[model samples]
Target: MTRARLKLNTKQIRARQRAGAVRGLHKAVNHLHERSTAVAPIEETTLINSAVASVDEGALRAAVSYDTVYAVRQHEELTWRHDPGRQAKYLEGPLVEESAMMLELIRAQIRRSLR
Candidate 1:
């Protein structure tokens, strides 16, 4: 009678999994930041460049920010850029799509790790 034997280091496996999850999170955040910047209205380039993304350790969530004095004016500028009567949802639309994509990516990563 013969039996197969396997050796597993749980600590090492857990470390690798954590590293992969972190990498996936960082990738998602970076993707969001890039998408936001691309969709942002740019005249002087300051607003677009101000877009930034980071992961919150406490919440394990990705957070994005457009840290600029004129961040509040984003809506007004986008809305009135083409026509004052119609609102141009440049930032919000792209952000929603990007967020969905990022979520899907993370889910895929999780599935892959499980395999």
Candidate 2:
């Protein structure tokens, strides 16, 4: 004879998932920020250093930003030139290129949280 029972606390699971997602998103955004920094146009270095990665827990949203007056211009102004290996769309380029890895980061965190 054998007996088996299962009980699932969905509320707890959801909380775990939410926490995991937030953590994962934070990590992903930070990585993106770092990647962007590596490629961001550098003068006084403010643009590259202003990089910030944030996750809104309430909205379950995330963003990576460069808080500089010239950030948008530097990113959008295709006419502009930089030294050696730096150019426009630093943030956008890395984000687009690494989106899959970002998702994987989130997934990995969620999987870890479940265990």
Candidate 3:
């Protein structure tokens, strides 16, 4: 019986994996942004528009920034729709809940790239 040999370019495979991971990170970030916006208390759309995502490949890290000046205030507020300080848990809650899904997304991307 003859054995079949398969050729694999390790460099190309690594590159594709990296690209796939980045793409997956981007998608996850966008999903987080959308979820944050949907749950956020909106006044003039500033916060919604301020939602931004960044990925650091070297560090293997991803983050979403609510760039508005009032982001902290809004998030930390104690009241909702009644008092001046409206407590809106926009970013943190969703991120924590969906963290596992983000990992799965990255894995899926890597799998696709390998294929």
Candidate 4:
């Protein structure tokens, strides 16, 4: 083969091999992830119980929790200098009003639970 033709063929082979290697790597990663994260449906009950334990608390408890949230939001804005989802507008505006509405709903639930 001429030198130019040989170089072209080598470049084409290298590209094909790189593409195949990437596909193989993706398949291996997906297979391991699927195998490791699977569990029986009943295991979901314990998963939910753990999640509830993480959040079960009264309104005063929730209001105090806001401090951590505020700090995280501040850090994200100043340090990151960009919103991850540009979601700050939602949170700073309508979400605040919606949250107050939700708090009223939560207080009603707490009162009913106490009775």
Model 2 vs truth, CA RMSD:
1.3
Model 3 agreement with the true structure over 3-60: per-residue lDDT tens digits: 9999988999889988888888877887787777777767887887888888887766
lDDT of 4 at 48: 17
Q: Which 10-residue window in model 1 sums to the lowest lDDT? A: 79-88
Error of 2 at 56 (Å): 0.6
1 versus 3: better TM-score goes to: 3
Steric clash pairs (candidate 3) = none
Listing every candidate in turn, what is its Cα RMSD in Å to the true structure after a full C-alpha superposition?
4.0, 1.3, 3.2, 24.4
Tell me the TM-score of each prediction against the true structure. Answer: 0.67, 0.93, 0.78, 0.29
Per-residue accuracy of model 1 over 1-115 as CA lDDT, tens digit each: 9999999888977766665576678778888777766666667878767778898644567777888897767644643563232233545666677878887767666556656
Could you tally the backbone clashes for each prediction? 0, 0, 0, 0
Q: Which run of 10 residues does model 3 get worst, by summed lDDT?
A: 78-87
| Candidate 4 C-alpha lDDT tens digits along 1-113 | 65654335667665555444444433333333232222211222332122111121221222111123243343235333432332323223333434555445444544443
Candidate 4 TM-score versus the reference: 0.29
Model 2, C-alpha of 67: deviation from truth (Å): 1.6
* Whole-model lDDT values for every prediction: 0.68, 0.89, 0.79, 0.34
Regions more than 4 Å wrong, model 1: 1-18, 76-78, 82-90
lDDT of 1 at 66: 80
